[model samples]
Target: MPSAPGTGKGGGPDHGYPPVGRLLPVGGGVVHALTTGSGPDVVLLHGASGNLRDFTFDLVGRLARDFRVTAFDRPGLGHSDPLHADGESPAEQAAVLDAAAGMLGLGRAVIVGHSFGGSVAMAWALEHPERVAAVVTLAGATMPWPGDLGPWYRIASTTFGAATVVPLVSGWLPDSYARNSVASIFAPQQPPDGYLEHVGIPLTLRRAAVLRSNVRQVAGLKPHVAAMARRYPGLSIPVEIVHGTADTIVPAAVHAHPMSRLLPNARLTKLPGIGHMPHHVAPDATLAAIRSAAVRAGLN
Candidate 1:
């Protein structure tokens, strides 16, 4: 792997953001993980178009105060290699992360996932039940939504888009555009100071592989979640769900509400007037959810 040039307007290798953790070889490629603190194990999986830095920005430090935390850059994003070109499903991502967790000696842990990571968390618990003590989702897209995704998703997942539009958009799209996109995700609640810099926006958008993986994963998420939803009742482990009422990106009514009803031991926290990034906007609620999960899981 090469270094990113810098987190400037344009994207290139060595975007000046070096890995803050070790790159462990997993299977054919490597998985980048930043581990810290001490106590019961807590594995954090970030959303699409993001890396482990999202947790390291604020949430990880808070959680680390009481529990051992490992934040992974999901395959095909950040420094982690893509599992395959066709796009790795949430189950595939979960399997790879589980392997990486085993290599790191992580035993049964409270798996926390945000957005796309939430789906991966579900997959993780479903596929490797013995390793998961509990589960937590922050505005997770757990169930399939009614309608199709936007035009960008439809176009970007195609062969033409992957070869042409992906590279063009990754290289030419200005930093302002990307910043605005980030801001929109956290609408109704502004992004915290220095979040754009800390989250590695340039690396997220500039890399064609990252874009392709994200596009395909998101485009194909509905069917996967639909399948996962059927098995929710089989999961008896405690689950804590945190979602913002105002989060249009992954609406609570669509995912969290139904999920709570499905899971036998599930608690839902709905933050009024909050948007998609509930973990950042409402850290208190997010922290509370994690603590609740830990206590319930007997890990505290």
Candidate 2:
């Protein structure tokens, strides 16, 4: 049974931003999670270089009104302890998060993934179908891209960079640079006022966030995704993919368009002239996609 919505951590130290959610000490390590509202279970996994705050900032609060919202900091991203010091593949992330959800009594929820999180959500749906009621992917990088992720990720993914370079960069990184980066993600559509501050984008520059993000991004992810893509046809659960046509980071034409045809029960929602961060740039459309997935999954 879902309990009434409650807060695990609210704000105190860093002005008004609290990263750690509910810390669950399972077996050995601790898993940080944020849970609220009470209804059909919904688990949110954030993108790369982010934490649960990404959702808690806006979408979770709104979705909580209709669903029990649980957003987790992927290992080493926010307050969650790292399962591996190097990095975790989407499949590995899915395993850890799925087990954590099981411990929380989240028994089969509509899994929503934004950007990098969308990849993990797909992995969960593919590997553990019983625990996933449905799937909603927002600008997910599911299909394999042709080339490398560019200079930054290439250099940062190395062990030497993760240990040395990342910390150095994170320490000297400017907030303005971070803000500009956020703005780029919202290209073709401006980000909502205070969205960057609300999500605590600067936190992504932290040592752990930087290292884990880079390591995961440039760690030859194409092979893994290609393998995952092969298994999509076998996945029978409801899937809703929400993408912006103008997303330069992960183009809908490349990822979402091809994915829609691949999945037997998948629908694509392509927003014209929108950029990468559709959840923030186009929240209503994203919410509608989630609702549609829920209905298709028989959760509504």
Candidate 2 residue runs with Cα over 4 Å from true position = 1-16, 208-210
Quick one: best lDDT, which candidate? 1
Can you give the TM-score per candidate against the true fold? 0.96, 0.91
> Model 1: runs farther than 4 Å from truth?
1-12
Q: How many residue pairs clash (N, CA or C atoms closer than 3 angstroms) in each of the candidate models, in the order given? A: 9, 0
lDDT tens readout by residue for model 1, 219-243: 9888999999999999999999999
lDDT of prediction 2: 0.78
**In model 2, what are the clashing residue pairs, if there are any?**
none
Q: Write the per-residue lDDT of candidate 2 for residues 54-133, one digit (tens) a residue.
A: 78778988898998989997765665556665567888788888888988899779999988888889999988889998
